[model samples]
Target chain A: MAKAKLEEIESPAMLEEFYRQMLFIRRFEEKCNVAYRLGKIGGYMHTYVGMEATAVGIHHAIKPTYDYMITAYRDHPQPLLLGTDPVKVMAEIMGRSDGMSRGKGGSMHVYDIERGFFGGWGIVGGHIPLGGGLAFASKYRNEDRVTICLLGDGAANQGVVFETMNMAALWDLPIIFCIENNEFAMGTRLEYHAADTELYKRGEPFGIKSERIDGMDVLSFHKDMQRIVDWTRENQKPYWVEIMNYRFLGHGAADNDRQLYRTKEEEDAAMKRDPIARLEEILLKRNVMTREKMEAIDEELTDQVEAIYEQADASPFPDASEVYDNVYTDMEPEKGH
Target chain B: MAAVEVATQTMSYRDAISKVLSEEIEANPDVFIMGEDIGRYQGTFRVTQGMFDKYGEKRIIDTPITEAGFTGIAIGAAMAGLRPVVEMMTMSFSILAMDQIINHAAKIHYMTGGQAKCPLVIRGPGGAAKQLSAQHTHCLEGWYAHAPGLKVVAPATAIDAYGMLRQAIRDDNPVIFTENPGLYTVMGEVPDDREFVVPFGKANILREGTDVSLVGYSRMTQINLAAAEKLAEQGVSAEVVDVRSLSPLDMTTINASVAKTHRAVVVYEDWKFGGFGGEIASRIAEESFDDLDAPVVRCGGLNVPTPYARNLELECIPDVDDVIAAVQKLG
Candidate 1:
C-alpha cells in the first residue's frame, strides 16, 4: 500500500511538473548522447534513460539546501534534479565555457556547491566516507543538513563503504546512504559480484536503519524514501536505502556492444516495470492526466532540450590563458615573517 | 609605553598546541576539531583536553574510528564554507584518508576552476615512538609533502608548533600539520600574543654558522641542533635551518645558505628511499652545484619497518651521531 503523501499528491499540475522534469532529463540525456556521437561532446557520456524516477522520486524526499548529494559517474540526472538548469547541465556535458563548471569539469566531475550537490566522483565507493564526513560537519555545526551519498551496487563491496557505515552509526551523523542497485554494475550482476546481494540487510551489522524499495515505482520510492529521510533528520543518524532500479541503455554511449552479460529476457522484464510507464499508469487510472497531456509535456521538453543544445553548441570553450587560474587562493603569501 | 610584552613562560609542545587551538577556536567561528576519541575522551594524547568542557560537544566532536570517512567529511565541509581542523591520530592513519586528501582536497580548487576552496587542516602526531612499531611508528610526512595540492607543515619547536598551526588554520588551502610524537613534550618559549603566525616556506635559522648548513624538520631539527651544540664545543659551527613547510619549500633560503657555507647536510626521520632529504639534496645539488665544497650529504632512518623494541626504535631513527657524521662527511 502507498503512503498518505502519495495518495494526497493527486494534483494534475504536480503530475505535469513531474512529467515535464523527467522528460526534460530524458531528452537532455538523449541530446548529449547524440552530441557525443557527433563528436561535439568528448570523453564519457553516461545517460539516465530509464532511471528518471529514482532521481525524480529521491529529489522530492529532502530539501536541496539542507541535504548534500554525492553520486558516482552515472550522474547526469542528479545535477538536473538538484535545481540545475537542464541547458547548463547539457552545456557542461558538451564541455563549453558557459557550462556549470566553466568547462573545466566534464561529466564525471560536475560540482555545483550553491545547490549542495558535490562533484560526481569517478572512483568507485570513494565518496562514501566523503558523504559521511559532510554529515559529521552538519551535526557538528548543529545544522539540520544531511548528506545523501549515492553509490552503485558495485561500490557496495568496497571496504571504505563498510568503514563509513560503521562510523556513521557510531557518530549518529545525519546521512542518507542511497544505493541505486541497478542490478548490473557496468556488466557484472550483483549476485555475480557478492555472495549476499542485498545491500539493506548488509547494513544490519552496523546497526544503520536500512530498507529495500521497488525503485521502478515512483510513488513507492517517494513514500519509502520519506520514512528514511525523516528518520535520518529526526534521529540525526545514518540510513540506507537500496533502490532496485534498471538502466534502459548500456553503461555509456560507447558501450553499444549490447550488455550480453544480462539476459535480454531479464532486460525486457525490467523494462515492463519501467518507472515512467508505472507512473503514467497511476496518473491515467487516477484521471489526473491523459495521453495527449503527457505527449504535450514531452513535446515541450523536447523543444527545451533542442534550445539548450543550440545554446551549448554556440557557447565558446574556455581560452587557453585561463588554464593557470584558480589553482590556489587569490591571496599571496604575506611578505617576510 | 608599549607594555613590554612578557614572553609567556616556556611551555611544552603539547600545551603549546592546546593553547594555539584554544586561541584560534576562540577567535575564529570557522574552526572546529573532529577525530576519534577527540571529545569527552579529550584526545588520545590529551591535546584536546578541556576543549570539550570549554567549547562544548559540537565544536569538539568525537567521531567513530573512520579516518577516511571523517577526513572526507572535513574536506566537504571545508568546500561548503567551513574551516575544519581534522586530527588523524597519527600520520600512519592518514594513508586511509589519502583519497580525500589527494583527490578531493588537493584537486577540487583546480578541478572546479576556482568555484571551491578547501580551507581545511588535517593534523596529528607523526614519526617513531616507543613500542608502537611498524604501523603506528612510521614517519610519513614526506608522503604528504610529495603531494602538490597540500601545504605540509612539520613544526620542530613549541614556538613553530604554536605559530605554524595558527597559520595553517587560517590558510585558504588545505594544510597537513605533521606533529612528531617524539617532540610533543619538548619545552620552549612561545610568544604570549595570539596574533603570532609563522609564514610557511621560510626556513628558521636556529644558529648562524660559517660551516655546513644543516637542514631538517620536526624531531630531526632537535637532533641537528643538539649535534650543532656538540660541534660548537669542537670548534665546528653548524648552521641549523628548519625547513618549516615542506611543499612550498624554502629553496631560496637553502640555496643562499649553501652558497655562503659551501656545503650542506639534509636530515629526515622517514625511510631513506624517496625520503624528504632526497628532495632537499636534489634541490641543493641542482641550484648550488657550482658553489661546491663537498657533495650534498643525506641522513635519515634506515630503510626497514620500525620494530616494537625500544632500542630498535631508537636505532631506526637518525640521532646526534648520524648528524655529526653527515656534517663531518660534508666537511
Candidate 2:
C-alpha cells in the first residue's frame, strides 16, 4: 500500500462530508440486499458492499456529468453518486416504469446517458472496449472529457481487456481502465483466475502508465485517482489502475455459501480494513464530528435508504404495451408470431 | 417502378456501394467508416479502393485485426453520437465478434431505454465465392436477422446495393448490411440521385407471373430470376420476388405473391436444415394458407460445411437447377 499523508483535505467539514457520502452508499446497498431477498428485485443484482471507497473516491476525482463513466454489472453507485435519484435507481432495480431503463434493463442494466454514465452492462469485461471507444469519440470530437471504465479483477483475464488497452494507448485516448480488485472473481480467488495476481501492471506492456493504490482509505485513493484523471485528460492518453479492496458480501444477491471459495477467517480479516470504518477512524482522529454526531448521521442515512426502498417498491411495473418501446428509434420489433 | 423521372448510371454492385458510401460520408459529418485494412489496403474486395485518398484518416479509419475490440469500440462510438460503418473483410469473421454484436451493439438502445443508439452499419461480403472455403464463406445475415435489436438487409442487385447502403449508413439502428461476394461484379443501372434510398422491408417483384413464385434474397434472388427464366421455358410462369430485407421482412408482398401464384419456392444460399429459408417458408404457409394450392417448398444450400474445392462448393450452394427441382417437388 503506497502511503500519501493527508494534509490539505483534513478539514472537519470535508471529513464529515466524506463520512456522510460513504455511509449513504453503504446504507443504500444494504437496502438493495433486503429488497432482493424480499423478491421485490429480480435477476442478478451485484451489490457494492466492501468496495465503497473506490466508487466514491473516483466520483470525487472527475466531473460527474461531463466525464463519461461505464462499469460491468456491479453498478448503481456510479449514477447514484453522480446525482441519479436513488429512488429512480431503486425503481430500476425494482423493474418499474419509472426506472431508468423503463424496466427493459433490470438490475444489471441501469443507464443514465444524459449524465454521461454509459450503463450498467452485465457481461464481464465485455464493456472494456466500449469504454475505450467512448474515449475515442470524445477525442474525435476534440473534447477534453475523461472516460473512467470500471471492471473487476476477474475481468482482467478477458482477451478484449488487453486488446482495448493496446488500442487506447495506440490511439492516445483519454481514458482510465480502473480494475476494482476486490480479490475475488465471483468465488474464484485472484490467484486462481489470473496468472499474475498483480493486475495493475496490465498497462505496462501496452506503454500505459499503471500502478496499484490503496482503496480502503478514501481520501488517499481520491487524491491518486484525481492525479491519474488529470494526467489522462492533459496527455490525452490511457492509464491502468488496480484499486485494492475486498467485498464483504458475496458476488451477487443470489450468491450464498462463501465457503465454496473462501473461509470465514479470511473474510473476518478483510473486514478489519472496511473502507467506511477506516474513513470514520480518520474523522475521529481529526475531530471532524463527535461520536454522537456520527451516530446521528448513520440513522439519517438509514432512514433515507428505507424511504428509497419504499418508494421503489410502491412504483408500478411498466405497461405490457411498452415492451416494444425503445427497441429502435424509428421502428418497433415484430410483436408476436 | 419510379414515380418520378431519375437519371441512372450502369455500374457494378461494388462500385454502386462505393459511390453511395462516398455520398453519405460527404453529407453527414457524423458518419465515418472503420475496420481492418478498410482504409490503406482499400478493403479485402476493393470496395473501399479509392475511399482512403478521398476521405482520409479522419473519416476512413484502419484498425488492427481485432474484431471484438474494434466492433465494441464502434458500438461505443455510435452510442456517443458518431455513425460508424464497420466493414468486416468477410461476414464469417463476424462470428469472432458475435458477443460484441449480439450482446452489446444490439442491446444498448433497448437497455438504455432509448437514451443511446447504435446508428451503425456493419457491411461486408457474405455467402460463398469461388474457393474461399468453410472458414471465409458464411451466409451470416440469417444469424444476425434472428437478433431483435438489429435490422438485417441483404440486397441482391447493384441498384439495391446502392440504395440500401445509403439507407443503412443513415439509419438510426444497427443494420447488418450483407453483400454476397457473387453480387459484387453483377451490373445494374443504379440511380445517380442522392435521395434515391430504397426503403427496407419492401420486397421487389422482378418478374410477375401466376403459376408460381420464386422468393429469395441476396445472390439467391439472382438465382431465382434465372429460375424464373428456366421455368418460363418449361411452360411455367414463375414470379420472381427479391426479398432484399430479412428482419423487417416484407411478408405483405410475399403473401400477395403467394396468393396470385398459389405456389412458392424459397431459395437461400445458407444450409438447408434450420436456415432463414425455413422462417420465410413457415411464414408463407402461416400467412397464405387459404390462398395456397400446395405446401411451400424451400430450396436451400446442401446441409454441409462449404468445401474448399470449387466443384464441391458449387454443389453446396442452391442454384437455378435446385430451385427448378424444388418447384417440381410442390407438384
Candidate 3:
C-alpha cells in the first residue's frame, strides 16, 4: 500500500495521534513483558508489539461504543484504543480484583460489554462464528451496527471459520471477517500450515467480496478499513479482509526458542519495516514533532506504562469467596469441588 | 402445594416440547429457534414440525449443517440479549460443537465477569433408539453436567419435559436439555397452562417405598419405574427418585430418599464407570453412610459402544431387568 500524500490528508494531527497510540501500545507491551518475567502477569501472555498498526487501524475504523468487535487471545491494544482503562487492562493481566474480568479471565480474556467489545476469546477460530452471531443479531433486530471479528492466520484453517463465512454471506449479515495473518500459527510457519497460503481466498468460494491488504501502514489501513466498515454497514453484507503483518515478540511470553522456525536475517528484514519506525518517519517528514520532542513523549509514555503496572500490582487479588461467583448469574454451582 | 384447578391433556413427549417452544417463541420476541432442517423440512426428529409455518424464516432460522458454527452463533446471539433455542439433530451431534458449547457457551458469563450471559438452550433427543448404533446413540447429559457454567437436565416424562423446557427457555444461563429418543412417543398428562414452569435441582419421588431407593433420570427413570413394579410384585417397596436436573444437583431430595429407604440403586443409561451416577453414588456414600443398611449399587449402561443389532443393543442398554438385578445386589 502506497502512503497517501500529506496534501491529500485533511487533518495532519491524526497522523501524530496514530504515532502516539502505536508508541503507547509498544511501551505497554514492553512493560507487560517485564511484568511477566517478574512473575506479575501469569498464564500465556501474548503481546501486541509488532501488530499495533492493525489494531490501531481497526480501532479507528469502527463506531466507538456502538459497533461490536471480537478477537482471539492476542488482545489488549484494541480495547485500549476503544477507551478501556489501561489500569483495568493491566490489572486483568496481573490477575487483580478490580480488573476487567475480575481477574478470572487473565490476559487472553479481556471483555468490555459496556463498550460493545464482546470478549477476548482464547480458542482459535472459536470467536469467528460468535462474530457472525453478533452481526446476525444486529440484522435480526434491524439495528444499524457492524461486527468486526479478528482471527490469526493459523485460525484461518479452522472449519468453523469457513462455516461462519458461508452463513454470514448467505444471510447478508453486517460483519467484517478480519484475518490478522501474522504468518505464524503459534510456531508453525504459514506455508507449512495452510494448504493455500492466500488466506483471504478462504472467503472467495462463498462469493464474499474479499481482499488482501498491507496492515503495516496505519494511515492507509485505517482508510481501507473505514471504507469496508461503511460498505458493510450500508449494504448489510459481510467482507473478508486479510491484514498482513508480523509479530515482533515471541508467540507468547514463554516462546524462547526463536531459532526453531525463523532466522535473524528474516527478523532483521521485518524489523526494518517496523510500523512504529515507519510512522515515526512520516511524523518527522510532516514536522509533527522533532526527534527530541518524540524522545520526551516516549519517556512520558514509558513512565505512564510503569505507573499502569504499579497500579495494577497494587490492586488486591480477588477474595476466596468469589471463586464460585459468576459460574451462573443467579444460581451457585456446587461449591468447592 | 395448593390444588388449583388446571386443565391437563395427554400429549406425546415431542408435542410437549413443541408446545413449550411455540409458546415461548410467541410469548417472547427475543425467543427464536435455529438449526439444520428445522425450517421447511421440519426437524430430523420431526420435533419442530409445523413450527416453520407459524414463525416464518426469521424466527425459525435454518442453518447450514455446521454445528460448531451455528452453536457459536447462537451463543453470540444470546450474549447480545436474544434467547435462542438451537436444536441438535441428535445429542450425538453436540460432540461436534463441544468446544463452542463447553468453552464458549459455558464460560462466557463467568469468564467475562458477569458482563455477558449465554441464555441459549441446546436441546435434542439422546440415548439409544432401535438402530442408531454407536455414533448416533449417546446420552451426553453426564458430560454437560460436568461443566460448571451449564445447566443439564434430562426429563423423563412429558409433563416434566413440558415444564422444564419452559424454564430452560427463560433461563439466563446455558442449558443442555436432553430428551431420550425412546421417550418421545411416550404419552402423559401435561398441563395446558403456559405458566407451568418446573424448578431445577429438585428430584421427584415417582413412587413412595421403603426397601430401596431406585434413582435415575431421563429414560433411565422410566426403567426404574418399571423395575419398581416388579420389585413390588416380589413384596419389595422400591422408591423411585427422578433426578430431573443434574448440574445444580439437589442432594437434599436424593439423600432424603436414601435416608428413608436405607439402600440405594443408581440406574443410568450412560456408561457406568465415569457417569454422573458415580457422583450420586459417591455423595450418598459420603453423606448418607449412617443411613445405609446395604451398599449403594449403580446399574449403568455397559461400557462397550452400543451395537446395531437388536440383541446387542438391548444388552448395552440398562433396562428394567438390569435395574431389578442391581436392586437385588444392593443386599
Candidate 4:
C-alpha cells in the first residue's frame, strides 16, 4: 500500500507520447484481429489490447539498450513498444520471410535481441528463471542494468516462479518480476487458479520486495515501475510487482466461446476503465490537448498503421529453401535428403 | 586408439571429468558450476569435489533441490554470455527440468534467429547403477538426442570424458553430456595437456577388426569393447566403434566400419524399444545397406524398468555376454 503523490503528468510531451503509444497498441491489436479473421495471419494470436499500460509503463522505465525484457506469448505490443519495427512484427504474424524471426517464430515468439527483448516464450511461467539468469549476467559482468520479466496471472502460479524468485533473492539479481494479472488465465479466473489470489505476495516468501499496482492507469503504472527499476538497478535485488489489469478481448482470436465464461455486461463494466480513454481524459483535463487535436492524431496514426499493414501484406513469403536455414551455427543439415 | 606416451596420467573417469571442469573454470572467468549438493557436499558422485574450495561460492554455486529453477537460471545465464555447467545429480532428476533443457536452452539460439547462444552443459551420470532401482536410473540420452538443437555426448573412457567435457564447455551450443556411474572408477590414461579437447561428431575406433562391427557409447561402449576382446579370442575380428557423440552421430566411422566388417551390432543400456540404438541400426540399414552381409543386430536393455535385485538388474541391461551372443548370432 505504498503511495506516490498523484500529480498531473508533469511533461506534456511524455503524456502525449504515452497516449499515442497506448492508442497505437490498441489499433495494432485490432488490425491483428482483422487480419487473423481475414486469413492473412495464422496460428495462435493473443492480442495485447487491454494490457497496453502494463507493457508500455514498465518498458518506458528501463534503458532499452542496456536493460533486458522478456515476456509470455501475448507479446506483440512489447516488441513494438521496445522499438521493433511494426512492419516486421506484422510480417512475422503473417508468417512472411521479412518477419522479425524470419517467419520461423510466429506471433508467440517475436524477439528483437538488439533492443534487449529476449523473447516471447510460448510456455506459461517458462521464462521466469531465464529472466533471473539475464539479470545474473548483468550482475556478473558488473553492469548497471536490470531485467524486467513479465508474466501473466496464470503463470504466477507456476512452481518455477517460486523457484526462480527464491534464487533471484538469494543471488540478489537485478530483475523485476511483473505479473500482468488480466483476471483470467485463458478461461480460468485468478480466484479458481490461485489459492491466495494476491499474486504479488507469492514473492514475499522468497524475501523479494513485492507490490500491487493499479495497471489501468498508465501514469501511475509508469511512476511505480520507474521507482522499482531505480531500486533494482541500485540495489541489484529482485522485486515483484503485480499489475492488476483486465484483458479487453478473448484469450486468443480462436477463443470464440469467451462468452461462455463471462457475460457481456461484465465486459462492458470493465471496458469503462479503459486505459486509453483514461489517459485521454487526463490529457484533456490538464489542457495538454483538445478533443479535436486528439482525434486528428488518432486519424493520422490509423492511416499510418493501415499503410504499414499493406506493406507487410505485400512482403514476400520465405523461400522454400529457407526451411533448412538457421538450424545450426556450425554445420548445415544435409541437403535434398 | 591414439597412443598417449608423453605426459600421460592414470585417472578415474570421475576425477578426469572433475579435472576438465576445474580447467574450464580457471581458463574462463565466465565459467561456473551449479547444482544440488555441488558445493559443500562436493557432489552427488564427487565429480565436482574440491571445486567450491578452489573457485569459492560465487563461481561454484550450490542450489536448492529444484531442477527446473536452477536449470532455467543456468540457461538464462548462458544466453547472457556465461558458460554454465549444470549437474543434474542424476539424469533421472533431469526429467523435472526437461522443459527448460529441451524447450528453452535447446531452442533459444535457433528460435531467437541466432541472436542468443545458450553455451551451457547439463551433465551427470546416466544409465542403471547396481541396485539403484527404477526411478534413480534412466538412460534418457535418446530423449535428449531426439531434440534438434542439442548436442548429446556419452563418454565411456576417462580420456573421452576429459577431452569431450572440455570441448562441450567451449562449444557455442547447449550440450547434454551424459556420464555412466558404472564407469566413474574405471581407470584410463588421460592426456596431461590441459587443452586436450576432443572434437565432436567424430567416433573413435577403439579396436580394429574385419569380421563385424560392435558399436556403442557410454558404459555400453565398455561392454562392446569387452565383447570385442572375447570375440577376438574366438577367432572373430570385431571392429569396436565407440559413438562418443550421439546427436551429430559419428555415422562416417560407423558406416566405414560396417562397410569393412559387412555386419553391425548396435548396443545401448536404454530399452530396446525406441532407444537411440534403434536410430543407429536404422541408419546403418538405410545408408550402408549395400555393404551389409547380414541384418544389423541390436543388443539393448530390456523393456522392463530397472529392478533392485542384482539378478534382475543383471538381466535388464546388456552385458558383454549378451553383446557376444548377438555378434555370434550375426555369424
Candidate 5:
C-alpha cells in the first residue's frame, strides 16, 4: 500500500486538524489508562493509543450524519472523532449519570445515535450484519448513505462476516467493511488463527472490491477511505478496506499478560512507526506547524483532557432508583424481578 | 364485561398470524418480512402464501439460509427505523443466531440507554411437531424469556395469535414471537378487525373456574383447556390461564386466579427442569403462597430431547392427560 501524497489535501489547516485529532485520542487514551489504574474507571477499558491515525482518518473522511459507523469494543476514539462530547464519553467510562449511555454502557459500548455512530458491540463480528442492515435501510429508503462497519482481524474469521459480505454484495448495499487488522486478536496472533493472513482478500469470495492500506499514514488512510466512501455512496455497493495497524497497549485494561505473547523488542519496533509521531513529522515537513506550536497544541489538549476527566469524575453516579429505567420503552418492568 | 356485537371469522392459526403480518405490512410501508422460503414458496407451512404476489419481492424478502446474518441485519434495520419481521425456519434454527438475538437485539436498547430501539420481531414455529426429532424440535421460549430486554409471546388461540402479532409488530422493542406448529391447523374464531391488538403482560382466563388454576401458554394452553374440561367432568372446576406473554409475564392474573382457586398446575411443552414452567411455579410460590391450598405442581415435557418416533415424542411432550394427572395430584 503506497502512501497517498499529502498534497491531495488542499489546506494545511486540515492536516493540522488531523494531527490535533490524533493527539487528542492519544492523550485521551493515556488519561483513560491512568484513570483505570487509579480505580476511577470500571469495567474493561480498551485504549486506542497506537491506532489513532486509522481512527481519525476513517472517521474524518465520512459524512457524520449521512454515513453510519459500527465497530468492535476498541471504540473510544471513533466516537470522540464523530463529535460525541469528550466529557460525556469520559463520564461514561467512569460510570457516571451524565455519560453518553447514562453510565449504563461503559467504555466498550459508546453510542451516539444522533451522530450515526451505531455502537461498539462487545461480541466479535456481531455487528457486521447489523452494518449491512443499516445499509439495507439506506437503500430501501432510497438514500445514498453508506455504512462503515469496523472489525478486528480476529473478527475477520467469524462466519457471520462472510455471510454479511455475501449479502451486502448481492444486494449492493452501501457499506464499507473496514477491518482494523492490528495483527493480534487480544493475545492470539493472526497466524495462529487465520490460514490466510491477507485480511482484505476475505471479501474476494463474495466478489466485493477489496484492498489493504497503510493505516499508520493518516494522509493515505484518509484519501483511500474518502474514495471508498464516495464510491459506496455513488454506486450503492459494499467495499472492503483492511487497515494494517497495530495496538501499542494491551488488548484491554486487565490484559497484563502481554509479555507471555509478545516481546518488548517487537513492541518497540511497532511503536517506532507511531501514528502520532508520523503525523507530527508530516505536519512539520509540510510547514503546517512548528515544533513549539505543536507542543503548545499538545499541552492545550492535555489540559483539556484533564479538565474533562475531572468533570466526569465529579459527576454523580446514576441513582439506584433508576436502575430499572430504559429496559423497555413502552412498559414499566416488574419491580425486583 | 358487556357483550359486544362484533363479528368474528373462523380461521386456522397459521392464517391468523399471516393475516396480522400482511395487515401490518399493508398498513406500514416500513414493515416487511424476511426469511427462507417466506417469499416465493410462501413459507414452509404456507403461512405467507400469496404474500409475495400481493406485496412484491421487496417487502417479502427471501433471505439465504443464514440465520445469524439476516437476524442481525433485521436488528440493524429495526435500529434504522424499519419494522422488520424475520421468520426463523423454526425455533431450533434460532440457536445459530442466538448471539444476535440475545446479545445484540435484546440489549441494544438498554445498552444505548434507550437511544436505539430494535423494533424487530423474530417469529417462527416452536416445540415438537410430528416426528421432527431432537435437532428440529426445541421449545426455546424459556431460553428467550430468560433475557431481560426481549419480549417473548406465545399465542395459542387464533384470536390471540392475530392480536398479539399485531401488537408485536407495532412494539418498539425486539420481540420473540413463537408459534406452535401443532396449533397451525387448529381452527378458531379470530376478530376480523385489523386494529385488534392483544396487550402484553396480560393473561386471559380461557375458562372460569374456582378449584384449580391451570396455567400454560402455546400448545400447552390447549392441553390445559382440555384438562380443564376433563376436570369439569370430574366435578373439579379448573380455571385455565393462557400466559401469552412470557418475559413480561402476566403474574398478576396468575396470582389472582391462584388466589381464587387455591391450587395451581403449571403446564408447558418445555422440559420440566429449568423450563419456563418453573418460573411460573416459583412466581406462584412467592406471590400466592398464603393463598395456596396445595403445593403448586408443574406438568411439563419429559426431561429428554424429543424423539423421532411418534410414541416416544408423544411421551416426551405434555399432553392433556399429564395436565389432568398433575392437577388431580394437587388434590
Candidate 6:
C-alpha cells in the first residue's frame, strides 16, 4: 500500500479538484457537528471524516451514469461527490423542504436518482445485496456499467454480504465491493469483530479478486480502484477492496468526548496519520499547490459552507401534509397494463 | 358484468402465469423474469416453461439460490425503470428476501420523495399442499397485504392470474402476487390475444346474495364459493366476494355488500391472529358499523404451525366446511 509519486498526476488540476472536494466534505461535516450540537440538524448523523479520501477517490474514478453506489450510514461525502446540491444536502440535514430527500431522509438516507447515487442505508449490511443487484442488472442488460457498493467493516459481518459475494462472483456481476475497513466498527475494534482482520480475504471464498490498500492516501486508493473498476468493467467480475483507514470523528456527534471505548494513546496514534493533514503534506512536498493556494482553497470552502448554512436556515420546514405524499409515486395509472 | 368467454383452448394455472409473463415480456422490453432454477432448468415448478427459449438467458435469469440477492436486484432494476418479475420458488423462500421486499422495494419510493418507483413484482406459489410441511407451506399474501407501501394480489382463476400479473408487471409500486401450488394444475379457458388486465383494488362479487357476504382470495376464493353453495342449501344465501387485490382492498365493494347483506364472514387460508382478515374486519367495522345485523365472523386456519400429516394439514387449512360453519354462525 505504498503511496504513488506526486509526479504521476499528469495534470495538477485533477489532484487539486480531489483535494478541494475532500476538504469541503471535511469542513461540511465539521459544520454539521456544530449545527447538530446546537439542535438544528436532528436524528442520526454518521460523519465520514477520516474516510473522505476513499470515497472521493473511488467516486471520481468512474462515470456517474455507468456506476451506481449504495453505502452504510457513513454517507455525507458520497452524495456531495456525486454532484448533489450542497445547499440541498444541508437543508435536508436541517429538515427543510429543499433538502436532498425533501426532509424525510435526513443524514443517513440521502438519495439522488438523477445522479445515479441510489441511497445511504441506515441498517448495516442491508444495502450490500442491493449493490450487488444493481451490478447484476447492469450486466444483465449488457449496459457495460459497474456498481461500486461501499460499506464499512461492521457490514462485512452480515450474511447477506457473503451471500451477495458468492452470487455476484458466480454471476460474474460488474460490481466492486468497496469495504472501508476503517479499523473499527463503531466502538468494537476490528480484531474483536473479525477473526481474520484482513477483510480483503473475505472475498477469497467467492473467488472475487481482492486488494488491501492504504485508504488514507487518495492516489493509492484511486490507482488501485481504477485497476479494479476497469477489470470488473471489462470482465464483468466482482472484486473487493479492503481500505486500511480510520474515522476521526466519533461514531456520531452524540459519541463526542466519550474516550472510554478506546485509549488516548490509540486515538493520538491515529490522529498523527490524519488523512487531511497527510494529503496536505503530500501536496506541499510535491508542490501540487503552494501554501498560499492551499489557504485560498480553504477560504473558498469556508465561504461555501457558510452560504450552505444560510440557505438551509432560510428554507422552510417540510409541509405537514408531505408526510403522506411520496410514499408511492403519485403517478396516474396509464390506460392499459 | 360479462361472463369470462369460454374458449376452445385451455391452459393450466401455471401456464396462465407463464402466458402473462410471456405476453408482458413480449409487449414490453423492460419486462423480465429472474429467479433460481428458472433459466436452463426452466423452473422448479416449470411455471416459466419455455421462457428461456423465447426470451433468452438475459430476460429469463437463473439466479444463485440467493433470494435476498436476486430480490434486491429486481428492486434495483425496477427503480432503474425495468419491470422485473421476481419469482420466489415458494412463499417460504420469500422470507429470506423479506427485508428487500418490505424495506427497500416497499419503502424506497416514499423514502426517496417519489423520485424512485419500484415497478417490481414478487410472485410465487403459497400455502399448504400435499405433504410440504411447516417450513415449505406459508400463505404470506396476508402478511404482505398488511404493508401499506406494497400491493398484494392473489389470483386464483386462470383469467385473474393472467390479468392481475399483467397489471402487477406494469404497476408503478411494488406488488406481491402470490399463487397456489395446488392450483397450478387447475385448468381454465384463456384468450389467445394478451389484452385482459384486471384493475387493482376491485373485488369481484362471485354470487350476489342478501343473507351473508363471504370474502376470500386466491385458492380460498374457490373454497368460499363451495361454502356459498352449501350455505344456500341451508337457506343462507351467502354472497361471495373474491378479493383479488389485498393491499389496495376494494373497501367500497365490501362496505356496499355488508350494508346490503347485513352479515359477513371473512375466509382466509392464513393463520388467525393478525392475518389479512383483521384488516378486512376492521375496515368493515369502521365503515359500515350500523349496517351489520350480526357480528362479522372470521374463518381461518388454526393458529399453529401446520404439521406434515395429510389429515393434520387438512385440519389446519380453512376449508369449505369452515366457511359454511362461519356463515352459519353469522346467521
What DockQ results do all the predictions give, each relative to the true complex?
Answer: 0.48, 0.81, 0.84, 0.68, 0.80, 0.54
lDDT of 1 by residue, A61-132 (tens): 888755888887888888887777766776777888887777877888777777888877777888777787
Q: Interface RMSD value for candidate 3, one decimal? A: 0.6
lDDT of 3 by residue, A98-185 (tens): 8998899999999998899987989889999899999989999999899999999999999999899889989999999998988899
Candidate 3 TM-score over all chains jointly: 0.98
Q: List the residue pairs that clash in candidate 5.
A: none
User: After aligning candidate 2 to the native by TM-score, how far in Å is the CA of A196 from where it should be?
Assistant: 1.0
TM-score of chain B of each: 0.97, 0.98, 0.98, 0.98, 0.98, 0.95
lDDT of 2 at B7: 88
Of 1 and 3, the candidate ahead on DockQ is 3
3 or 4, greater by lDDT: 3
Report the C-alpha displacement of residue B223, candidate 2, in angstroms: 0.6
Query: Candidate 6 A-chain TM?
Result: 0.94
Clashing pairs in 6: A92-A99, A327-B110
Compared with the true structure, all predictions reach lDDT values of 0.84, 0.91, 0.92, 0.90, 0.91, 0.84
In terms of lDDT, the poorest run of 10 residues in model 3 chain B is B322-331
Q: How does model 3 fare in lDDT?
A: 0.92
Selected candidate, larger TM-score, 4 vs 6: 4
Model 4 chain A: weakest 10-residue lDDT segment is A1-10
Give model 4's docking category.
medium
- Report the lDDT tens digits of candidate 5 across residue range A1-337: 2234445563788888888999999999999999999999888889988999898888878888668989989889888988899999999888999998899999999999898999888998999999989999989999979998999999999999989998998888999999998999888999998999988888888889999999999887888888888888888999998999999999999999889889999999999999989888877887888999999999999999999999999999999887888888877666774
Q: Where is model 1 more than 4 Å wrong at Cα?
A: A1-8, A254-260, A282-293, A330-337, B1-6
* lDDT against true structure, model 2: 0.91
Candidate 2: where is the Cα deviation over 4 Å? A1-10, B1-4
lDDT of 4 by residue, A80-100 (tens): 888889999998888888888
Clashing pairs for model 1 are A133-B73, A134-B73
Tell me which of candidates 3 and 6 scores higher on lDDT.
Answer: 3
Candidate 6 lDDT by residue in tens digits, A21-58? 88999999999999999999888898888878888888
Q: Model 1, residue B59: what's the lDDT?
A: 78
